[model samples]
Every structure is written in C-alpha cells, then in structure tokens.
Target: MLTLSLILLPIIAGLITLAVKGETAKTVAVVSAFAELALGAYLYSSFVPDATSQFSVSYDWIHSAGIKFSVGVDGISLILVFLTTLMVPFIILSTFGNNYKNASTLFALILFMQAALVGVFTAKDAFLFYFFFEAALIPVYFIAAIWGGENRIKVTFKFFVYTIFGSLFMLLALVYLYLLTPGTHTADISALYQAARVLDVETQSYLFGAFFIAFAIKMPLFPFHTWQPDTYEEAPTAGTMLLSGIMLKMGVYGLIRFVLPIVPLGVDKWGFVAIILSVTGIVYGSIIAIQQKDMKRLIAYSSFAHVGLMSAGIFSRNIDGIQGALIQMLAHGINVVGLFFIVEIIQQRTQSRELSRLGGITQSTPNLTVYFIILMLGSVALPLTNGFVGEFLLLKGVYEYNVWIGAVAGLTIILGAVYMLRMVQKSMFGVTSGITEGFADLTFNEKIVLFPLSFLVIALGVAPNIFLKVTEPAVSQLLSIIK
Candidate 1:
C-alpha cells in the first residue's frame, strides 16, 4: 500500500491541480509534493538496514506469464527514491514566483513526472519497469513542447524519437528474455537474473547490447548524443533540469540494476569498448563545450562529459567503480540541476546566455556570483566538493581495473577545470557589460531554490560517508553476484 501510494499520490495531485486556479494551484501542488516527501522520509527513517527487501509490496498481476505487481527497495533504491522525493518538492517551490502561463497544467505535468519516475525506480518486474520507463517520457515531452524556448517543437520531436527508437529495441530484448524464462516463467527482475545466469554467453551478449544501446542513447553518450544539446537549449529551464538531473540517471540506474549483474560475462567481454567510448565522449564534450558561446549548449555538452565519466565507471566492473558511479549519479544530478537553474536565473534577468555577450556579473551581483562560483567549483571537481569524491572514486576504480584506461580518463579532470574556469572567467569577471550592469541579485524565491542545493553540494562533499553507507550493502550484494 505504501508503495502504491508513492506512485499514486502525484497522479492524484496532478488531477486536483488541474481544477485549481492561481495561487491555489501552486499551493495545492506544493502541499502534494510536501506530503509525498514526508512519506518518502518516513520510508527512509523506518528502513531496516540489514534487510534484503525493505518496504516491499507484491501482488500477482499476470500468472500465465509469471509477472507480478512487485515493488521493493534495498538501500540502493531507497537513496534514489529519497533523492527523487526530496528534489520534486524543491523543484515545485523553485517555481513559486515564475509566470508559468498555465500554472495548473504545468504543475500537473510535474506531479505526473514525479509519479512516473518513482515507478521507474521502485518496479521489480521487468514489464512493469518498461511500462513506467516509457510512460515517464510523455509528460516531459509535453512540458518541453508547451513551455520551452524557441524551436521547441523540432527539438522535442528529435528528443522523443531518438529515445523511443532506442527503447523499442530494449523492449524487444525484454520480450526475448521473457521467452527464455524457465519453468513457470517470470518477468520479475530477480527471476530474470537467475535465468540470465544459465543462458549461453552469446545470448547474454545480444541481450546486453540491446539494453546497452537503449541506456546509452538515454544517457546521450557521444555518438548517440546528437539530440541532447538542442533539446537542452530549447527546453524550458524546469524541463531541462528534470531531464538532465533525474531522467539521465535512469540510464545509469538501469546499467547498475539490470545490465552489470545479470550479464557479467557479456560486460566483461565488451566493457573495454564502453570504456573507450566514454573516454572519447569526455574529451569530445569538453572540447566542444570550450568553444560554445551559448550557455545552455555549453552546459549541455558539459553534461555529456560528466555522464561519460559515469559510464566509464560503470564499465570498470569493480566494486569501487560501481559504487562511485552510483554516488556520481546522485551528485551529478544535483549539480546539473543547480547549474541549469543558474543558467535560467541568468537568462531570466539578462535575457541571454551567450558567454560572448555577457560580462562583469560579479561586480553587479556578488551574491549570485558567489553561488555560481561554488557551483562551477563543484562542476570542476574541486576538493571537498561533491564532484571531487565521485570523480576520485571513479578514477580510482578505473585505475584498479586498468592503469592505461585510468591515465587516459584522468585527463577529464584537467579538461573539466579548464572549460569550467574559462566559462566562469568569461561570464562572471571583467568590466560590466550593458546587459550585466543592470543585473539583479537572486530574488528570495531564487535563493530558496539555490540554498539547499548548495548546502548539499558542500555537505555531501565533506561527508559522503552518509550516502556511501546507504549504497554499500546493495553494491556489495551486486558485486557478489557478478563474482
């Protein structure tokens, strides 16, 4: 019931929001998100640390094919669930003073997105996971097309088509896996894992590649990443935030949950190819980012770079690599959201995000500059920042696997700092430009959005142990399976 409520609350709130008007609608959305957050917190507080299945709920849905309406959390899912719940309310609050033309519909979409994402993480059955996975894309597509910047329609179409094409292949792969299930047959992920163990290496390789292609496109890694920059630049700030911050993690999460453990031999066989692609993406993204004048596009490329490192870590096939990738997923999500918010705030105030056209922001808006600098540092992986811990662990994990791979990937740290610092120098320092001279500091509402994120950036950096502790057991169990 608790699991069901987590999935249902947002949907109910979305319907209620449509009937509401003006401030009342925003209030209703806020209250709904807050209540959902409260429930997520309760789940976290009551979670049994050593339990294999915590807060689980399962029911028979289709017995003939052996599918069940199953949901549960171990530590890994719990942390991500908490992140999703916590961030949604903050995202709602962040929109407080904005003129979101159709407030009710916009808020409703957000709530719907919330419900779908929760379903994605909580689902234990493969068919249920696929259902939620595809379902989550609908509201986001609407959000981008309806409220986004110029060129939204084309960008949204490309984004939708690119991901859907990849996912369709994954769905086909799932069906293939289902057909191979033994005895009573099941789509439960655990049952699938057991079945995968006995499958021949050739079959596992095909299934792994099918799933990998889907997740890679979703992560928008390198060669498959052509659609991302336009989509990020054209989408509304909030939609971009949700996409970069949360949606991308679905790919990383899928890799950890479904790919690595279930097809260890396949991963072992092709992991090097993944590592090479990730390294190439890191370099490719950074080089492109340095040349971009558009702030949104720059950040979009930077996002590609960050997630590239995460992919490398996932392919490292070691405990540290997997654990680091998980931590990086959360850290990257929070940091990207904060970075995009800053972009939005700047655009809102200055009417532009072109680095060449803006100057001397620090002289006019010191407070906003301070926050921006911190976020930049986080992006560059400054020591004692959340970015540092994840990168360090990821690199260390890579080194443990292969010294040459680690050496090549390590260039990202320097390259990341170079582009990020260059962006800061160009955008924030120097004589005030006409556009920046009249710039205003962060409004109260903006501060409400940034403060908590910044705090987490530092807090998690200084004491990542809190999050690491939550993920360790699950990661260990996963690693044990691969071994």
Candidate 2:
C-alpha cells in the first residue's frame, strides 16, 4: 500500500492540477509534492535496512503475456526513491521564481513525470520497470519541448529520437529474457534474473550489449552523449533538473539492476570496454566543461563528467564501487540541481549566463555566492562534503578493478576543481561587469530551495552512513548474485 501510494499520489495530483488554472495549480503541485515526500519519509522510516524487498504488492496484469504489476523497494530502490521524492519539491520550488505561459500544464507534467519516476524506481517486474522507464520520458519531453528555448524543437527532436532508439534495444532484451523463462513464464525480476543467468555466454553477451546501449544512451555516455549538452542547455531549468537530477539515474540504476546481475558473464567479457568508454567520458566531459563559457552548458558538461564516474564505478562491480555509485547518485542529484538553480538565478537577475559577461555577483548577492560555493565544493568532492565520500569510494573501487584506469579517472577531482572554481571566480568573484553591476541577492523563495540542498551537501558528506548503511546489504546481496 505504501509503495503503491508513492506511485499513485503524484498521478492523482497531476490530474487535479490539470483541472485547476493559474497560480493555484502550482500551489496544488507543491502541496501534493510535499505530501508525497512525507509518505516517502514514512516508507523510509518503516523500511528495514537489509536485503529483503519491502512494501511489495503484486497483481495480475497480463496473465497470457506472463506479465504482472509487481512493485516493491529494497534498500537500493529506497535510496533512489528517496532521491526522487527529496528533489521534486525543490525542482518545483526552483520554478516558483519564473512564470511560464501555460503554468498549469507545466506543473502537471512535472507531477506526472515524478509519478513515473517513482514507478521506475520501485518496479519489481522487469516489464514494469521498462514500462516506467519509457513512460518517464513523455512528460519531460513535453516539458522541454513546450516550454524550452527557441531551438527546443530541433534539439528535443534529436533527444527524443536518440532515447527512443536506444530504448527499443532494451525492450528487445527484456522480451528475449521473458521468453526464456521456465514454464509459466513470467517477467518477475527475480525469475528473469534466474533465467538470464543460465543462458550461454554468447547469448548473455548479446543481451548485455542490448541492455548497455539503452542505459548508456540514457546516461548519454560518451559517443551516445551528443544529445545531452544541447538538450540540457535548451530545456528550461526545471526540465534540466529532471534530466540531470533524477532521470539520468534511471540509466545508472538500470546498469546496476538489469545489466550487472542478469548477465555477469557478458559483463566479465565486455565490461572492460564499458569501463574504457566511461573513463574516456570522464576526461572528455571535464575538458569540454572547462572551455564552456555558457553557464548552463558548462554545468551540462560537468554533469556528463560526474555521470561518467558513476558509470565507471558501477562497472567496477565491487561492493565499494556499487555503493559509491549509489551514494554518489544521491549526492550528484542534489548538487547538480543546486548548480543549475544557481545558473537560473544568475540568468534571471543579470540576464546572462556567459561567465565572461558576468562578474562580482558575490559582492552584492553574498547569500547566493555562499550557496554556490557550498554546492561547488561538493561537486569538486572537497573533504567532509558529500562529493568527497562517494568519489573516494568510487576511486577505491576503480583502483581495485585496475590501478591505471583508477589513476586516469582520478583526474575528475582536479579537473572538476579547476572548472568549477574558475566558474565561481569569473561569475561570482571578480570585478563587477556592466551587466552584473547591480545584481540582486537571493530571494526568500530562492533561499527555501538552496538552504536545504546546501544542508544535504554537507549532511551527506559528514555522515554518509545515513545512506551507506541502508544500501550496503542490498548491494552485498546483488554482488552475491553476480558471483
């Protein structure tokens, strides 16, 4: 019932929001989002920090097709569920500063997207997971395409085509796994895992390729990442938050949930190639970010770099690697959303996002500067901050996998500091530019959004155990399956 409510509440709220008009719709959306967050908090509190799936509910959906509506949360799912619920309100609140043309419709789509995201995180059936997986894209599509920048149509078209193309392969892979199940075939995840493990090495390798393509594109990793920077730049900030904060995790989670355990042999065979690509992306994204003058595009490339590390950590396939990925997913979502919000604030006040055109914002907007620096430090993985714990563990895991790759990947920290601090120096610290001469400080509404995110950046850093302890058991159980 708890699991089901988390999925249904946002959907119900979205419908109600659609019926309402004007400012009321956004108010309704925010209240409903908080309600959903409260429910998520309860679910987390009641949850046992162990390997078992909790709050499970299953019912027949398509018996002939061997599919059922199955949903639940283990520790792994809970962490993501926590991230989704925790971020939505801030994502919504961050938008309170701007008024869109069709405000009601925009808020409604965000709520709908949240529902699908919860569904994606909690699904216990393989087909259900894929269903939510693709379903999550629709509202965000409309959000980006409808309310985004002038080039939105062209950019979003490519974004839509790329993700849909990759998802087809995942659907094919899931269908193949479904047919291979034993008598009374089912798409139940546990059953699929059992069935997939028995396939010949070559067959599993093919499945691995199919699944990896789908997730990699969603993660928009390296070569597949061409769509991301443009999409993030063109999309509205809220849409960008959905893409960076919660949506990309769908891919990383897919790699952990579907790719790792189901096709261990294939991973053993081709995993090295995946690691190489991920590491390459880390360097490539950071370098590109360093050269970006546009604030949004710079952060877009920074996100690409951060996710590349998360992908590499997952492929490392150690407890430390996977755990780092898990915790880092949460940390990255918070930090990136904060960073994008800062960009939005700057653009809103100074009417500019280019670092060269802006300066000395900190001289006036001291509060904004502080929040930006905190989130920035977290991104660069400064010690005793959230990013540090995850990056340290990720480095440890990658090192265990191979010292050379780990050594190359370590450049993320140095490069991240370079690009991030440089961004701060140029945008917030130096002499006031003509455009930023009288930049305003953070609004009360803006503080409501940044303060909590800033708190999490430090909170998670100091005591990551709050998350690590919960995920450790489920991660151990997953590694056992792969072994």
Candidate 3:
C-alpha cells in the first residue's frame, strides 16, 4: 500500500496540476511533493533492513505471458527511493521564482517524472522495471524540449535518440531473460536472478553486453556520455536536476539489480572493460570540466566525472566498493543538485553564466558564497563533508580491486578541487565584472532549497551509518548471489 501510494501520488498530483489555475499549480505540486516525502520517511522508519522486500504488491497482468504488475522495495531500493523523494520537493521549490511559460505543464511533467522514477526504483519485475525505465524518459523529454533553451529541440532530440536506442536493447534483453524463466515464462526479478545464475557462460556474456550498454548510456559512462552536457546545458534547471539527481541513478541501480547478480559470470569476464571505461570517464569528464567556461556545462561535466566513479565502484564488486557506491549515490545527488541550483541563481541574477564575465560575487553575496563553498567542498571530497565518506570508501574499494586503477581514480580529488576552486575564484572572488555588478544574495525560496541540502552534506558526512545500514543487507544479498 505504501509503495503504491508513493508511486501514484506524484502521478495523481501531476494530473491535478495540469487542470490547476495560476499559482495554484505550483502550490499543489509542492504540497503533494511534501506529502510524498513524508510518506517516504515513514516507509524508511518502518522498513526492516533484514527483510527482502517490503510493501510488496503484485497482480496478474498478462497471465499467458507471465508478466505481473509487481513492485516493492528492499534496503537497496529504499536508498534510491529515498533519493527520489528527498530531492523532488527541493527541485520544485528551486523553481518558485522562475515563471516558466506554461508553468503548470512544466511542474506537471516534473511530477510525472518523479512518479516514474519511484516506479523504477521500486519495481520487482523485469518488464515492470523496464516499463518504468522507459516511461521516465517521456515526461523528461517533454520537459526539456518544451521548456528548455533555444537549442533544446536539437539537444533533446539527441538525448531521446541515444537513450531510446539503449532502451530498445534493454527491452530486448528483458524478453530474452523472461523466456528463459523456468516453467511458465515470468518476469519476476527474483526468479530471473535464479534462472540467470545457471545460464551458460556464453549466454550470460550476451546478457551482460545487452544490460551493460543500456545502463552505460544512462550513466553515460565515458564514450557514451556525449549527449549529457549538451542536454544539461539546453534543458531548464529543473530538468537538469531531474537528470542528474535521480534519473541517472536508474542506470546505476539497474547494474546492481540486473547486471551484477543475474550475470555474475559475465560481469567477472567483462567487468574490467567496464571499469576501464568508467575510470576513463572520471578523468575525461574532470578534464573537460576544468576547461569549461559555462557554469552550467561545467557542472554537467562534473556530474559525468562523479557518476563515473560510482560506476567504477559497482564493477569493483567488493563489499566496500558496493557500499561506497550506495553512499555516494545519495551524496552525489544532493551535491549536484546544489551546484546546478547555484548555476541557476547566478544566471538569474547576473543574466550570465560566463566565467569570464563574472567576478567578485562573494564581495556582495556572502550567503551565496558560503553555500557555494560548502557544496564545492563536498564535491571535492573534503574531510568531514558528505563527499569525503563516499569518495574515501569508493577509493578504498577500487584500491582493493586493483591498486593502479585506484591510484588513477583517486586523482579525482585533486582535479575536482582544481576546477571547482578555480571556478569559484573566477566567478565569485575576483574583481566585479560589468555583468555581475548587480549580483544579489539568494532569495527566500533559494535559501529554502540550499540550506537543507548544505545541512545534509555535513550530517551524512559525519554519520554515514544512517544511510549505510539500510544498504548493507541488500549489498550482502547481492554479493551472495554474485558468489
């Protein structure tokens, strides 16, 4: 019942928002998002970490085809679910000052995306997971295309084509896996996992290739990442947040759910290649980010870098690696959204994101500078901040897998600090430029969005156990299956 409501509320609210008039749409969306967050918190409180799945509900949807309307959450699912619910209200709140054209429709699309994200995280069946997986792209497509920058049409097209291309492979792989189910064909994920365990090595390799491509494109790891920065630059801030904060996690989560357990042999065989690509992305993205003059695009490349590390952690296939991935997912989502919102704030006030056209912002806006520094520190993985715990654990995990790769990957901290602090120096600390002379402090709504995120960066860094405990059992279960 809880899972059903969590999935339905955003969808229901989105519909109602479409019919709403004037400012009521934003209010309705915000209120509904808050309600969903409360429900998620309650679910977390009641969740038994040792349990396999909680709030599970399934119904016969296609009797002959063996596909069921199945959805549930375990410890692993809960963390991603928590990230979804946790980020949404703030995503909505961040936009309160901007009067986007057809604002109701924009909010509605965002909420719709939310519902699909929750569904993706909670789905317990392969087809159901894929359904939500593809379903999520639709509203985001509309959001980016309809409400985005001028080149939005072009960027959105690329994003759609690239993602849909990967999704087709996912659908194909799901069908292949489903047919191999014992007795009557079924799409139950657990059953699929059991069946996948016994699959021949060659078949597992094929499945691995299929699953990895889909997730890789979503994670946009390395060479597959071309679509990301352009999409982030062209789309509206809210849309970018959706993409970075929760949408990308779908791919990382899929790796945990599908590729790791179901195709362990294939993972063992091809995992090194995946790690190489991920590490390459981390380096590639960080280098590109350093050269970016556009604030938003810089953050976009930074996201590519951060996600690359998370992917590398997944392939490391050690307890520390997996747990670090889990912790980092939450941390990354919060920090990236904060960075994007800061970009939005700068653009809104100065009417420019050009690093060269911006300067000495800290001289006027103490509040914004403080928040920016905090988020920046978190991104660079400073000690006693949220980013530190995850990056440390992730580095330790990668080190366990192969010291040379870990050594290469650990360069993220140095490179991250270089680009981020340099960005701050040019944008916030130097002499005021003509464009930034009118810079103002964050608005009430902006503070509402940023302060809480800043708080989480510290709280989670200081005591990661709150998030780590929930994922331990699920990670344990996954390792058992992989073994």
Candidate 4:
C-alpha cells in the first residue's frame, strides 16, 4: 500500500546508509528524504479528505493476543503525515552545511527517526501506536547524547527519562483499554475508542489522567517542560530540529487522536484544568523568553509559548480550536526550524549566540538579516505570514470557549511581539559587532533551507485553506465524537 511505502522507504534507505562511509551517507540520506517527501506529497494529493481512513493496510501480527500490524491515514492523519514528510528533507538538507563525525551513522539515525515518526502518525492499532511512540525516542537519544555539548549526556538523559516515564503511563492506559474491549480482546484503535467511550465519567477521568500526563509531558507543557530548554540548547542543530519541529507534535496529535474521543466525559470534566496549564504556559514561557540572552534558549522558550497556545486551542474543544491547533502545528514546525537554523548559522559563523555579542549582523549580511526578519515575523504571527491565520483562529476558538480565558491567552500576541522585536533589535540592527564584521551572507546550502521556508510562510498565510479544507471534515468528526 502507498501508506506502507510512505513509512518503510526511509527505513530501507536508512539501513542502506548505515553501510555507507563518509559524506556519501549524508548524500544518500538527503536524497532518500527528498524522495520520501515526494511520496508524502503524492499521498496528500491522493487522499480523499473525507472522514474515513484511506489507503489502509492491516494484517495479523500477534494472532493469539489479538494484536495487529495496522496503519492508515484519514484526513486527521493526513496533515501530520504531510508535515513529517515535508519537514524531514529540509531537516536533512540543513545539515549538509556540517560534516559531523561518523556522518553515515548520524544521517542514518535521522532517517530512522523519520521512519519511526511516520509510524507514530500512521499506526492504527493501540499497541502499534505505543510501539512507534516509544521507538522514536531511541535514535534521538543517541543523536542528542552522542553528538551534543558538554552537558549533553546529562541533559539528554533527563529528556529521555522524562519522556519514557510519561510513555509508561500511556502504555498502561492502552493496555487497560485493550482489556476493556468486548468479546475477544484486541488492540485495534477503533475498538478501543468505542470501549473507552462507554465508560462512566468517573472511570474516564482516571483514564484521562493517564493519557493526558503522557501527552502533556510530550508537548512538555509548563511544569513538565523543565528539560526542553536545556536539551534544545545542548543538542546538535539537527537534533534540536527533530525535537522542536516534529517529535513534540506527537503529543498534540495524540491528544486529538486518543484522548479527546475516548474520554469525552473526562474532557468535559477537566478540560478547563488543561486549558489553565496551557494558558499559564503561554504567559509563563513568553515572560521567561524576555529575559534569556542565548538565542537558542530564547527561541526554546518562545517555542514553549507558541506550543502553549496550540495546546490551549486544542483543549478549547471547538471547530476553530482544533483546526487552528492543526494548522498552527504545521506553521510552528516550519517557523521553529527556520529560527533554529538561523541561530545555528550565527553560532557556526561567530561562535556565540549571546545578544550582547551579536548586534548589527545586518551591516555585513543584509540578505541573512532579511531572512531572519521574515522568519521572526512568522514566529510573531505577523499578518499575512503563516503564523497569523493559525493564531487568529486559535484565539477565536479559545474566546468562544470562554471570553476570560481567551483574554488571558491573548496576552501571548502582545508579549510575543515585545520579546521577539527585542531580539530583532539587539541582534540585527545598528553597528556590526567585532564578531560580525566579517560575516558572510547566506550560503548556497543555507539558501537551500531558508528560501523554501520563507516562501511557505507567505504562501500558506495567503491560502491556509489548502491545509484547512483537508482537515475540516475530520475535525468535525472529532467534535461530534467529543459530544
């Protein structure tokens, strides 16, 4: 099936890359990633945009236990799959500027991570979903721990431990629901959904806690987010891309797929509490970002705030909220990768990311300055940029949920602009600092990554319905399920 090819091609290519030597592996990986992206685009074109799952592939994997190796894409899964396939080639190509040691192994890990991520997005069986969910952590763990900074070992470990702990709860929740299935027990997601929906409000509340803690930790919301800034600051740029750009989406996607439908009663009971955490995180992360000096760490905090808004929108439980969250997920992924890529180029060229040391880059590298400004505008949700449409709808969704909560959450718009504009002023304007005096303009490889991203920021903003249309039916289906 086309869906299977979408998930498996990178896996085979990654295995092939492991045997390659030198930069050849990186080349192979990049080409294969581009191929994967093309396949994903084809899948998107072919997808019907209906509520029903399409291009399904299923078979018995463990007959006695009623386990199955099943996967498919509905409109719900389609957009996330498109995001995964679309972002990865760029993620791979962005690394062409660096020649990491053991390049084969490094690139292979990325491809492996890609394969696992596709699996997470596509898996239709409960245990199958959990398998891919946890599988993604392994390659990223090595990517961070082995290739990261002086504190990489400890920080990556903490990140690994935190995520794994959360997943244990998900594993328990899935198995509990699996056992609850009527007749012969099974791990099919549809069956699990039905079984879960019929539970009493009290029981669903407990189940919600289990799934919510896991997804909340993955989204790394608020108090559960201590490990993120450190890990992002220390990991390789490519690894940071993986975490912020894609892996975090696993949590948001899980909330839409598993938590909301299976535990609607629980959502009705405690969705307000979830909204509180998300909104608090939005305000809390924005305020903290205002104080950070390191560019990557600041962006890390900014990423937290942006994700908080998306999370708030998702928990808002309206058509606008869910659709906005979906659209914002794609926009945020693109903008964050561009932001981090800019930071990586700066650090690579000047060996520093501190604002005090970074002024006036525009004096010498006006082109890069332009690129950074566009990406920053995208991050701040400037009108006609990709961020604007999503943020607008998200705010509308939350406001509809409760005017007071939406008003609190709306502070993100103002604070986001303040800190982001501060970053632009301190880093790009005025006289060139000593470190930036000899700054080179954007490289060909750098252009390879930023140009397309810049174009996407504008194009998607002008016509967001290209994404929204495919997702509307599915989101409507989800809303009906929640009822």
RMSD in Å for model 4? 0.8
Taking the tens digit of each residue's C-alpha lDDT, what string does model 2 give over 62-172? Answer: 988889899999999999999999999999999999989989899899999999999999999998999999999999999999999999999999999999999999999
Ranking by lDDT: 2, 3, 4, 1
Query: Could you give candidate 3's per-residue lDDT for residues 160-205 as a string of tens digits?
Result: 9999999888888888888888898889999888878678889889
Q: Give the alpha carbon lDDT tens digit for every residue of 1-483 in model 1.
A: 777799999999999999989999999999999999999988878877652867788889897878888898887787778778878887777677579899899999999999988888899999999988898899999999999888999999999999999899889888877777888788989877887888778888888899999999998787999999999999888888888888888888888888898888888888889889988999999999989999888989999999998899888878788778888877887788888888888887788899987888887787788888888888889989999988999999888888998998898898898888888888889887878887888888888888888888899899998778878888888888888
In order, candidate lDDTs are 0.87, 0.95, 0.92, 0.92
Q: Which stretches of candidate 2 lie over 4 Å from their true place?
A: none
Number of the top lDDT candidate: 2
TM-score of 2: 0.99
Model 4 agreement with the true structure over 1-483: per-residue lDDT tens digits: 998998889999999999999777887999999999999999999988789999999999998889998999988788889999989999888888887888788889999999899999999999999999998999999999988999999999999999999999989899899999988899999898899967999999989999999998898898899999999999999999999999999999999999899999999999999999999999999999999999999999998998889889999999999999999999999999999999999999999999999888888787788889998999899999999989999999999999999999999999999888998898888788889888888998899899999899999899999999999999999888788
Clashing pairs in 4: none
What local lDDT does model 1 show for residue 398?
Answer: 87
Candidate 3 TM-score over all chains jointly: 0.99
lDDT score of model 1?
Answer: 0.87
Residue 432 lDDT in candidate 3: 92
Question: How does candidate 3 score on lDDT?
Answer: 0.92
Better of 2 and 3 by lDDT: 2
